[model samples]
Target: MTAEQQTLLEKSYKDFTRNGALLSDEAKEELRKIDAALAVVKLKFGENVLAETQAYQLHLTDAADLSGLPEGTIEAAHDLAKSLDKEGWIFTLDYPSYIPFVTYADKRELRKEIALAAGRKAFQANEHNNEKNVLEIVNLRHQRAQLLGYSSHANFILEERMAQRPEKVNAFLQDLLDKAKPAALKEFQELQDFAKKLDGIEQLEKWDSAYYAEKLKQQKFDLDDEKLKPYFNLAYVLAGAFDVAKQLYGLSFTEVDTIDKYHEDVQTFEVRDENDAFVAIFYADFFPRKGKRNGAWMTSYKPQYWKDGQEERPHVSIVCNFTKPTASRPSLLTFNEVTTLFHEFGHALHGILADTTYPTLSGTSVFWDFVELPSQIMENWCYEEACLANFAKHYETAEVIPMALVDKIKESASFQEGMATLRQISFGLLDMGWHGANPSLIEKVKDFERTQFASTSLYPDVADNAMSTSFSHIFDGGYSSGYYSYKWAEVLDADAFDFFKQEGIFNRAIGEKFKTNILAKGGTEHPMVLYKRFRGQEPRVEPLLKRAGLL
Candidate 1:
């Protein structure tokens, strides 16, 4: 907190944007010392993420313990429990175990208890409490940003994004909120009305959101995840994504067993061009466990670049929190999760297929706003008829998805677009509320968070539950003030998809242009230039608005 200490931290940053490869020989030596301290801190960081994902499992060895579980739940429980030296079943913090229990567990008290158990993490008086660690991380980040001549962390980060600066990010978030507020209000009213009528519930609580929303969606569209999940077995869904990529870009993938992986669950593949030459290595890690985080992300353990007279192939991994395969069933994906897989894999493809010369400027390492373009645009392919038929098939019958169901999926594509946009904008604004301002005057973190959510708060804040205490993205993760990039990239993705829709979703000319201009170029040039080179002009908001049915 001292000025002298702050200056030292700032000086060490050396400006990430201006300085290419800030880790030079001299800098690397200095960083070796910094890394020593960072190794200690990051060790705790990695351990906490792993512990949250892997540790503190629930072991139920008795068959009766699986009483209320869904069809395959008991099998998954037994398999997991047996592995951990139990009799009946094993349950951990994996999405398959945790999320279904949270949303559909018939036992309300059990759900609440486990929910509290999960929420209580990193807040209790123990080393796992990330509160102090979070504060330290934020302060360190502030110092790093200041070193780069930015007013705040948000300013430093957004400057290189499509949103350009904190001011622009704030403006974009607010502008979207202006458009989305009415739709959100209408959606909430409808959900509340439905809850009152169907469940005779006069009050809606935090727990009611997902449950009731599923109910409303089923009533409105005659569609629910369970009915659709049968058609979205993992291999089919991945094939659907692969088919879309091939149609759109002439890219191909072949399963390869030669590569080394950190875990047995990971499946490795070799990406290739139409001529069958090697492109990149793609690792897919699907399932929830203590070792993984709670969301989906695309990460490059090895980046694509030119070094030592050879272009190094990239290794891209897509880590997702999906339900593990139960005893009777393989992992079945909800349509939304299918889109998410497509999104992360799109990011993986961007990295794996990268043809760049510099590591810093490779794959999805472009501007924050533009980085989402490939991933988000790939979600578009999920809706195409040819695309779906390629991957969407009945798990048991092995029949391709019915065309009528594909039609239903497309019709429901914009079903909750307005409400979804509202949620995304609200989070981005919340991010701005924190890093965009001076927190010194704000002593209470909970009160500060409440104010940030004031304009968008649908459910009353649970006094015992504070989101800031556990918001890993803005605190320990790199998002901070840049969380708005999701929506920011939506604009780019939607617009870019329009170009493909005009030509053909799989037009090779356009795909090659995009590969050369956008994916392969990375951060070597301004994102706008790369975007325009591909789209032949600047991206537009109209396409996004149209896609969201807001127009």
Candidate 2:
């Protein structure tokens, strides 16, 4: 058998034994109970978070309360209010509503109100509170890990991941924390000083972070989403993504009308390679509406695999909550949303290019720590002038995006990156705190989180806000003890992109190397081996640090 087949067989056997196939009958029964309970509590945790998000509303009747908001944001809020049969405007805790309010709203008290509301989701004294759920999840996960002969829940989960052990993950995070903390502290002081000078604010609070950061960014770079949105019509940005794919990997995307979609908003496309051979079916749904959750992600309806000497192409989809087009204007995206589109498209490309034999190891069915490499690396293109020149045109004038703005976008890329890195480190630390050690004695979720965040804390803590209560990525989603993978993959992406920059961003030879060794290979080999095959060396942290302006 081939080495890939051997690896798959060994992995399948390990999965069975790790899941308790080798356990005694009595232990198996206990494991079953634990799994069942985990399922119920995880569902409850997510439901409570969603309920809390939908329950709160900041209904505004005064026009002055909307100061500093962009026109599109105001119009969307007005439309929301009209739909709810209210006056003035309405804003919910959804990203489309909440992010804009915190980032751009000039009303300090109002921003604080919404920010606190967002931070307190599922952490309040109400039916939707998730404090108990958080405790139950960690304890149950710990118990299950011990039952499976692992030291901690993180140990059990990490065994199947690139990190492989809790200690390695901890050391990796701590190394990053050590490198980032000093820079983060310096950035925080600068932001505080700027906030005081700009607004005469005495002390910065959790609510002030986004607003002041946006202000400081604008002051430093003269760049803001509102000024750049005109150049990033959603359709144009998407076409730019397709063009990058075509240039990089010789793929084509053609919209089709025959495929049935779950929503009218979903657009279906047929993806093909250079020779006009079918590759994959792509589905894209972009917009916010009732019942649709916030955030963006890529998912697959079918997996690509070779069966009976026939290769089955995959069906992949990207779902995002970009702003909808209003009657007066087309759907213009913020620079952040533009990167998000490319990120998910990168994942779709992974699935589209899969050429593995086994279904289980196809496409994004790779290590938790390595999966983000494709998505995050794609975001680098959004900042590239060569890539942006293709599709970033003004909606009204058809003018290409100004080079000055492109330079600003690249300049601001590392603006407050220190603080950002620290924030991610804090989350990774918090996740490790819950699963890396025994949690049976963890009595209070907020207290536990506070202890975990003590090293990474920036703003003064709000007693009422407990992040773990609403952190569905670990409790309800697949992240679990793997939140650190985001930073881990950043290291890989930075190193990989550096190779492209050395060769050329659009170098077809380098692109084909990436597509063959990284995208098409999937989990056929270990992630590090595949990465090295493409990059010609083990990934480096220097590139990430240098790019983030930490070095």
Assess each prediction's global lDDT (C-alpha) against the native. Answer: 0.74, 0.93
Number of the top-ranking candidate, with lDDT as the measure: 2
Number of colliding residue pairs in each model: 11, 0
Compute the lDDT for candidate 2: 0.93
Error of 1 at 406 (Å): 1.5
- Which candidate leads the pack in TM-score? 2
Off by more than 4 A, model 2: none
Q: How well does candidate 2 match the true structure in TM-score terms?
A: 0.99
Please give the distance, in angstroms, between residue 375's alpha carbon in candidate 1 and its true position after superposition. 0.7
- Across 1-551, the per-residue lDDT of candidate 1 in tens digits comes to 44323433443353543332454576555545543554465556546655654655666555554554566556666677777676776666566776665555555455566666566556556667655555555555555555445788787777667677788888888888888788788888888899899978787766677667777787887876778889999878888787776766677888888999988889998888788877888899987755467888989999988878987888889999777777568899878889999999889878876776667667877767778888988999889986787778899998988888888788888776777888787778777877775554656566777888888888756765666556667765668787888898889898988998898877888888877887777666667867887888988899988878787
